[model samples]
Target: MADKIPQKCPECGGSFTAKKLTTTCPHCGTKTELGIDGNARYAYVAPKPNQGKTFTATDLLNEFSAKHVSGPGMPDLMGVNKILKTVSINDVCPESGMTPLHWAIVNRNRAVFSLCLARGADASKRGTGEYEIAPIELAHREGLTDFVDRLVSHGASADDDMLRPIKEQRQVAAAATRERAAVVKETIARLTKEGKRAWYQEQVKHFEEILGIKSSVARGRGIRAFEKVPVKSLAEKNLGMEEWLIKLHDLAFEGGATLFCEKGLTVSSKIRLLLAPTKSVLDVVAVSNLLSPDEPGCERVDIGRQLEKLYVELPYRILECGRDGVLGDIRAMPDDLEGLAKRLLDICPHYGQTLQAGNGKPWEKVDDVTAVKNDLTESRGFFLTWD
Candidate 1:
């Protein structure tokens, strides 16, 4: 009988060391002796740990409320989540058909709501009695904005009569419901960006078709504006060769650029077409300086030998354009200056770079074409060899 006796204390309602007929409550220093008719009442009771509840949810509501009476962040069963996982998680109040979800919504306890959700609590379950309200509707009425979003995102229907008016309410509406214009602006912005991408794609395709080669460098994004090819015919019958020599000398003297040239050529403009496939200044310059004029090399190299070899080596024989891809206007008599300049730039990338750069500013030294153009404009004859 003594071994089976409970050891709970009365004074502080704490456990005590039981011995003989006397025991002291360690918590409050209270002493008690067993009465003739032994009863454990509040003096001694064996703790039944982990005992499954024999009562209903309605009867447990008061205890539940007491446990969670503390404010937000400290949930009722927060520390006992694992224990709750072992219980009848779907229990509801008999009076209102309100489950733990409803209670969580009423308290706006997001932690508890998430826990209940994870444990198979139904958020969309309707309450009983005069009014049927879901957890989302309850939160909406309570003006719990975050709860409303969490509920909606987790499968709560905004179309429900109970949740719709709450969805329209300014204080509780979700981000999409509240700022409707943001959706439109976001869509418009996306479409606008896509449209620009498509336009640029088409432009790239057209550019490739015109030159029969692809260009990675975008039109407006390039370092320098695509300029006209400045080619001159160099037949012995004409003084074009002499004029070209004088221009090269002035380029070295005025603009601090040394340019070597091939003696002359009467073949078609296909020589310029060779540069269409390349955009690198180094690559274009290499092809332009094909046959070295130096013993080993000099600051400049002549491309006459390479051009002569290509004229015989390349199978295609039709003249694509005028000398150095100079597109002399067919309709414009013989000396159409405006027509010639306009047609000159509509050429291969290599031809354009070489023709423009050879006159004064070397393509590689075009660090700042805009600044160079400005300098040319300001100093005129001193910075530029020829127009």
Candidate 2:
């Protein structure tokens, strides 16, 4: 005996496992299981891969009646031909505010326009009133003479005097562009001149600070030295006082030292508990401190010792000046001051306080009290005479 094949119930498209199946679908309770000699029914079959690819002209006609517009390309043309078989051209795109006649006329497609007119498209079907200006106006502006001719032949108004002087309007636009360019050029020239003047003034000030001289002489010297010094040389390393202060007042700005004095000290008789630094004392301390460094094998040991010795000896000279209630005025020894300021800027850059070029029209970054005081006095344009 052979094993039996399972029967598929037609109602639910499901297989029945038993060899002798009942007449009803077990899942749906429909009479799908037929007896052996009952009425014959065909089995379900899947379609071929390209079975639904093509459309008939009647299909295109129905679709166009339903949808007002069709896209471009081979597939769209196939569908368009299908709709054309069943419907007239005028009835196809009525809802779109354009008939096939209007589309063919506007696009200057003479063959398409002929086909549409042969298919009973009305020549005088005007589009909806939503357009501010009609389609013919657009064709005129774009200089599409072919489309203009087609519209005129289709009974569109050719004598409409709605044209603007487009050439004159374009010339005016070109003139406006030239004016804007000139304004930009003027602004750029103005900025350049302003920058040059500001830089010149700053250089003049820098020279006076170094040479302890009048601005007029220093200004001329600064201009000459500015040309001589290479920008790379200035940036390579920190400046030393001898290289800075030894120049003539007409020389470019360089470096120097600060000569401290007793009057510059914060401590008094009542506040003697606090350390009061006099020029001579400070010089001795600087030399001694450099000679005895906390770190061993430090770089530039020999040069460091020499600088320390110079720092110690110079304070004594300033002490004499301090006796007259004046710390050697910074302006009097511009080169020395520049070197001192540079050195101080190198190490205790903030002089034990936070470094800030404070907010204002003119900016300054001096954390050391004495340096800050001198800067203020110099800025005031008065001889900083100590009482």
Residues 294-383, model 2: lDDT tens digits: 222221233233334544533212221122222222234334554554543343333312211221111121235544445534532111
TM-score of each: 0.28, 0.20
* Candidate 1 ranges with C-alpha deviation above 4 Å: 1-55, 59-64, 67-73, 76-86, 160-387
lDDT of 1 by residue, 88-144 (tens): 556776775777777777766655678777877666777665226877777877877
The clash count of every prediction, one per candidate, is 2, 15
Residue-level lDDT for 204 in candidate 2: 46
Task: Please report the candidate that would top TM-score against the real structure.
Answer: 1
TM-score, candidate 2, is 0.20
* Cand. 2 Cα-lDDT: 0.35
lDDT of 1 at 241: 36
Question: Model 2 residue 120 lDDT?
Answer: 59
